[model samples]
Target: MRCKSLDFIFDYFQQIPTMELEEITFSGWTAIEEKNLHAGEKPKDEKVYTMYHGTFLKYVQHIITSGFQRSRDGMLGSGVYVSRNIDKAKCYPLNADKKEAVVLKLKVRVGKVKKIDIDNHPLQKSWHQNGYDSCWVPPNCGFTAIKSGREEDCVWDPARIVVVDVACCLDDKTRWDLRKQIRGMNNHGAKDGCSQCHQNTSNTGSHPIQSCWTCTKQICPFQKKHVCNK
Candidate 1:
């Protein structure tokens, strides 16, 4: 597909008054049985379920990876979903409750090619390295940047991210309850204590052990110290 500038894409989405839910096949892991499946195991099949739960809009589906066969290429067209049922997650604390299977809505966009000024290309070096060929910008978490091009030839642009509310699924009371629960969790904080280190102490010295940002768990200080010293 021809690459459009972020401003152009944003303008295109802005013209879309109503966003429609187009059911797309998604293949990925689920919280059904085995928490962690082997590489050869087939991924679970799921579809996008879009709905508006009062104030919050939800788009639940199995996680899906970008079609890129290689990992070195970085994440492109990957869809990420935040699970509501944290207990079922393999990485989450085992003692947590496993009740509802909910996930947060995600927004994704495909990368496209955009022509750049030959003299003032952003990715001029990359372009030269790739036999002075046309550059491609891979999609990231938010925006897309040209890949395999001279730095001066390519540029990153912010596109208009379209977030749609298909329809209302949860009632007012239920939505309010969920909102309250999420707020409470955010205010209180998540579970802590690193599984690897099991150290619950705070940073003592100048070079203290770093904690996992997600779970607020402290890593092994001794291990970090050894690595740094080496």
Candidate 2:
């Protein structure tokens, strides 16, 4: 009877809903902006735009913790590059595998915007020097260097770009890794696996199509039998 009660309690706990990091909703971007930006620094137009930044999966946690850093140099001079269109953002960190890419949703304070349409625009790399807070490149602006044929933006200050959320594409490799982790935790004789399965006494545990990991038999074959001697 004690064992049955323990089993019931374990099952109940397992059924409880748990929230993961990815499942958490983000709505505090305004609070972040309010705390970081002063009234004198805010743009007169004060229009906040949604943008995205593409990077490697390895940098997601670091960016979230430490915030974004301005790039030393780029096509648009030294600034953090982003895009209003998500498709354009996803094409970033160029020449890398798409499976490892991640996109960060950002809230940008694009104050006093400037457009650099032509290849040799005088302010192409010095717009910030002339008091422009951000620069935009329109789609298909007849620039030979604009390979994506999409619009792009570069914000001069990293503080103006607030990360709102992280988006990751779960490709085959990511899925396989997740499955492996779940299996390691759910197998018999493992850390969180069935303690009743004595057959799988070593580190390795078996998982065969709803079968018992201990004796490799039918699912929960010994649940009513009270003991498994197989």
Candidate 3:
């Protein structure tokens, strides 16, 4: 399918079975106060300037990538636009300015970055906070962390699309149309809100129901009602 936005990619990851996925982790720079006092450290032990170091970058990669490509399409090197793989989503610490060879080497040895810390790595922090994951590294999605025995293939090839997301504009559009339809039925007596047509989320809010309008076999509550209302 043609990917018009990034949500298509995130929805794909959300479909992934969590049992097959891992929670996100990362590594980068951090700031720490200096503490090199000759005889007396102020405050009984004054702390000095800080520096960024990495120590856990490899872990947070997947979770962060999924988040970045969640809502909208974003930029990468060469102004390339594409979808992300939720299962293998993660970010790397290379700038567009870095040499491709160096970036490739760094990505392959992601685990070696364990010593790096977030405070030192502002970009990494940006990735984490913004959910930047699922970026393409050279041949595929960034290489997977290598453990001894479980040879799971982490690298993703764009050429081999194993799955795709279906087009479902029905959800949002239905709510809008339903409002019109219900309004026509009410002729101004019935109040129009999702809560009235649907129930409270139980958590205490309402979401519009999903369904197709004309071109379908009976699919969802909205569709069934369309037929019954007729």
Candidate 4:
């Protein structure tokens, strides 16, 4: 299937299985200050700084398990995108409902950094090629796309980033709605075989395909290796 948007795939995968609400333990996890940095400030060289990564709730468990993956293309090509500003992290997965949004607190080791404040910087997307470990975009620097007027950063390597914690960025009512949806999914799955597996009975003993959001076919497309291109 066409990749379309990351959020689109995540929308359908919301019923893959409920997220384990229990606290997760991360190895070698180090805590950093939760405060925000000034608009034009850069992280201390070769030192760890606190950062945030915004994403939908459905993908949280997967990310925590698999770790951050580098983006194939971005303002700073081939990097794991993050921001020191929590508000900026709260603005991601833009096309989806905010109720499913979450901000991941992280500890990042920005080995060497560069600034790309200009619209036409020679290495706007190629800073990694010049031995830079990260790129910084200052707020209100004439980048029309950053409506939040917030600072953003792109780390070249995902290994340099470690997930510290996850925070839900929703109001009480929205959180209620989220819990309701999850409970509904769980209840429905209990009654209807499996949502994700549909009729693919091979793995029924392990985890039945509860109700697949994709289609009603006996086998899920995803099980056949059909999935989002991106």
Instruction: Compare the candidates by lDDT and give the number of the best one.
Output: 4
Please give the ranking of all candidate structures by TM-score, highest first, separated by commas. 4, 2, 1, 3
Candidate 1 per-residue lDDT, tens place, 35-121, comes to 332212222222122211111222121011111121122222212211111221222222323222222222212133233333434
Better of 1 and 4 by lDDT: 4
Q: What is the lDDT ranking, best to worst? A: 4, 2, 1, 3
Better of 2 and 4 by lDDT: 4
lDDT values, one for every candidate = 0.28, 0.66, 0.25, 0.68
Which candidate model has the greater lDDT, 1 or 3? 1
**Model 4, residue 85: what's the lDDT?**
81
lDDT, candidate 1, at 185? 32
Which candidate number has the best TM-score? Answer: 4
Tens-digit lDDT track for model 2 on 54-121? 99877765565445788999889999998877888888779878778877777787888888889989
Better of 1 and 3 by TM-score: 1
| Candidate 1 stretches greater than 4 Å from native | 1-76, 81-169, 193-230
Tens digit per residue, CA lDDT, model 4, 1-230:
65779778888898588777986542221234435456478676677788888988887655554457788997667888888888888888787798778777777878898988878789989999998999888888887657777988999877677565654556766555544544443344333234553221222333433333344333343242333222
Show model 3 residue runs off by greater than 4 Å: 1-121, 131-133, 139-211, 220-230
Q: Quickly count the clashes in candidate 1.
A: 23
Q: What RMSD does model 1 have?
A: 25.0
